[model samples]
Target: MTVIGIAADFDPPHRGHAYLLDRARDLGDEVVVFLNADYTAHHTPPLLPYRLRREIVLELGADEVIPVRGYHQRFPLAYTVPVRVRLMAEEGVDVILDAGPSRNLDRLREHVERVLEVSDLFSIPPNVPARNVVRWLAAVEYVNRELGTDVELLLIPELEGYSGRKIRAALRRSGYSPDSLRKVRRHLPRETFKKLERYLKARTPPIARRKELLDVLNRASSYELCSIAHLNTIAVREILRGRPFRSERQVWGALRRADYGSVLTRLALANTECRVTSDEIARIALSWCVERLVPENQSPDSMYRRDWFVAALSSHGVKARDADRLYKRADSYEEARRLARRRYGVDPGVPRFETLIGEARVSDGEYRPAISANGRLGVVEDGFQELRATAFGATLLRYVLDDPFVDAVIRVEDEEARLIVFPGDSP
Candidate 1:
């Protein structure tokens, strides 16, 4: 079978990305796009997560969208290209596609049996020639070694876009304001722009303010602080050590100047070492739930102004179990379900999951269950279905659903709706 694969970071995918999909669709029966993971993106890691990026590309009509975990690894790097290529081969990618200027031809031939260069980057505004050349050459070398003679490249110049760099810069400079978003809208596809707009409105700043970080750390755990502080675990951990649990004064001294996320965390925790209350913790947990609902939009605080989280939890009608157990983070979704089961005896599931009774069960180490939403028990398969699971309400459903297990039975108590999940579970 002939399969086509294209690789890109597509941070907020532009029209150029859609052009590749359209062309690839014409070239092969299946077109798969390999997206760069968050850590592997060309610019700062504040770029969208791999899942979100894959979702955007899939919307572009690619048959499949797989994230390239460590995008740039090759000879003289951390890992060998052959190993990576073998993995792609396992996915049945017969040809890998790329795009660039006409001069990229010579180097393109070295990788893959067939190569497709979509254009000479004509639609792109001119930029630093030397840097583009270096990046282009390095990509060519890496792709050549990665795909070798087994893949093919075909050149078709039809892609157009506002360079990714420009969009990111505009977003940063504008502080994601209305006019800036409007300007950005000119460069992205309609659906892509919609997602981007939501992201801009809801996402945390790529860098945290020193004052804001200090305020949040005071009431948040090292883990919670990481999310609020927007720092990695290591940095957060480093800022959280001491004798008799170091004083805020000492921590502040150590954090005089550091990554915004860490600095923010230390500052937030400065005086909050032992002052965090249950209400504050509950607010944090609800915030986490909001994050799960809209992973791209990190503004869980938005739900609070309207009492949305509390109202939703109250609707679940949980009884006979302490809801606080739900707020504890789980290492994984499956673990979250397990913790729920331990707390509630019978598994909490949508009335229309695998059986009419809606008893939850683990599948592939994941909780695959229907969720009761909008007064209807609906399961989000490839798409959402409003109908019952089966005529008898007991029909076993196919396909795993990824909505939160807590969706079906939330308990609103103690002035907060504590979401149930296992410890270590990220939204």
Candidate 2:
């Protein structure tokens, strides 16, 4: 009699597993399924234990199911490969039909003849209800090359309903008979159902901070400190680390000194150490910070506060055009200060620049607005107030310029620089 072998993680043996196995039974007289070991799934842990998963497979109509265990092996799948192959040979099976040409099946096929591979017959562009058709076809080609056999492979498109993980969860919670696999039925107990529901409710996708900068930035408090230049300097470093912040303070610290250009430059290097692109991280982080610190509800248009509009503009270095939309009502200094107090918790009359200068014992007449040769707005030298303002502008300015807008900026000798803006882009 022909013997067929199936290898799968079978994390929860849903309708898809049964659908594939039932088709395997039709092609061969006996079916042997090798369940993936618990440790084998370390890279991607399965929801259920291997033993229970094997039992679930049998209940779904697998003829013979076996536990294939190994420890301390570089390739555990490699060890189980030979064991299943020998079982096929000892059974005196002439022909073999496998669910798909997996690594273990390839090992078995190397020792056998008349190997048949059944794979994704139903897929898009040319076939039926499955998405991974081409992938299965590719696996068959790989097996054919390794085994040096003709390998009669059939592609079958089997339609299946219900995912294994959801089914496992449903059964455990309802305390229903696991045999209710064929259909959705009330087999689990009420208490089990409640517990399962609670467990599922608590289970959430891990917040991927390292995946994007925005993801990290969005989690910070509205009052978190931020800096565009800081982000630009450290974009590559943070992306390489790819770990979530332990506290709001950590995220706040991360928001320092970044701009779109610096982000683009760092990402352009494409260092293997940094898995994510610089732009992606910057965009995510910028968007996240903006969303919480300066939301649409608190936007210039929604709330006419000049200080807020100025602060937001300064933080991102927003131009008059962009700032105009956000704070259309703030046409004068009084309005700007009034809005600033409501939004930024700053007293517009407090005179931060004057206070800092007074503390430094600098004369007010010595406070001259520094100007660039290009005849554009420039930051003051030793104007500690300008340093703070520039830092704020570094956070809010929407444009990145070649000219530094701070108290002191590094420049290559005789290298003409562009006017630097915040968010690191030109208006």
Candidate 3:
């Protein structure tokens, strides 16, 4: 099988790159592209990272992408023609394709069946959309003049101006939204847009995670970790600044000093090797809250920023925790219970503290004087003491109600009464 060789940076393959590959594929059995390695510097405009660029090239339909690692470093004195020729020979390639103008066609001819050169069709000045024709003609002439190789220079003009410069410039100027970029990308063919999106994602400056953090702050509650949310947001933003947000404590201190914007901006600018996943962040948020905000014995009443509570629990892959945090303090019990069930698999039948309060009494004496036939406080000693006792009673009621075998009996009849029934139905 004849192996066709293509030289490419393939930084998120664009339409022009795809055109060359497609044209070459028709003339060969297998096509192999020499990819720029992570360290190679390609003067291609709006370049993406090497790994991402290679992936895009693959997506664009390259049969194989051979990493051209150390090529530039090792062949610093040689032009692209010699280096590529050496690389192709190693791969046992027969035919060769160059997207750029071939500078050394005669030399290349010695190593391959044919050397084809393709140009960026879209980059031609719109006024003279076929400007590449001049370049193509010149390339052919160069071969005829320099090497006496009358080699054919194929001209594939990209009509839409899909150059990296154009794409980047357009993206910066609001000529396109990200969503619009994705939609219009379809017009460029699969491989082309894959390269484009890859380049954009790789080279685009990281946005601060602070905005997301602040958004988190809008909903955090006390029972969750307030400091952790602030820290996570800061840490993510710090990554953008080329600095890692090392610890929750550091984030907390920075937040205490109201240095939020500075750290956030830093993290927003720095890019991580891995983008933060929602599940990962959710887990982080949950841990932060569970450890910081919602400590074992703390009441939910003192909390602020309810969103943080919800986000933390949800972020931690604990959908149940998130639902509980969101609904636990709801004004309506049914609403709270319903949300708990739907989001977290919490059964509404679980006994509440309220159920216990109504069924238990602190003392028999306290329960006795209250029952007047007319529903009046029949010579009660002190209403304040009674109120305090009742509050205590309510808490105990809920604790016991949680027991599966305990059936609480709370009654207010004739005047007032309450009781607790156990497994045997005895009160």
**Each model's Cα RMSD:** 20.6, 20.9, 26.4
lDDT, residue 60, candidate 2: 66
Per-residue lDDT of 1-427 in model 2, one digit per residue for the tens?
6666665666555555677778888887887776766433222234455655666677667788766553201121211233334444454433444343343444334323211132111111222222222333333443445433333445445443445446555544544333433344233223333333443354421211123434444442211111222223233234324335554335334333223342233222221112222222334333423433222222222222233355445554455454544344454546655665565555434222111211112333332222222222333435323222344433222222211111122121122212221221112
CA lDDT, every model vs. true structure: 0.43, 0.37, 0.40
Cα error of candidate 1 at position 170, Å: 0.5
RMSD to native, candidate 2 = 20.9
Pick by lDDT: 1 or 2, better one:
1
Q: After best superposition, candidate 1 residue 335: deviation in angstroms?
A: 59
Q: Which ten residues in a row have the lowest lDDT in candidate 3?
A: 296-305
Q: Which ranges in model 1 have alpha carbons more than 4 Å from their true place? A: 70-86, 103-149, 158-161, 205-427
- How does candidate 2 fare on TM-score? 0.32
Question: Could you tell me every candidate's TM-score relative to the true structure?
Answer: 0.40, 0.32, 0.32
Best by TM-score: 1
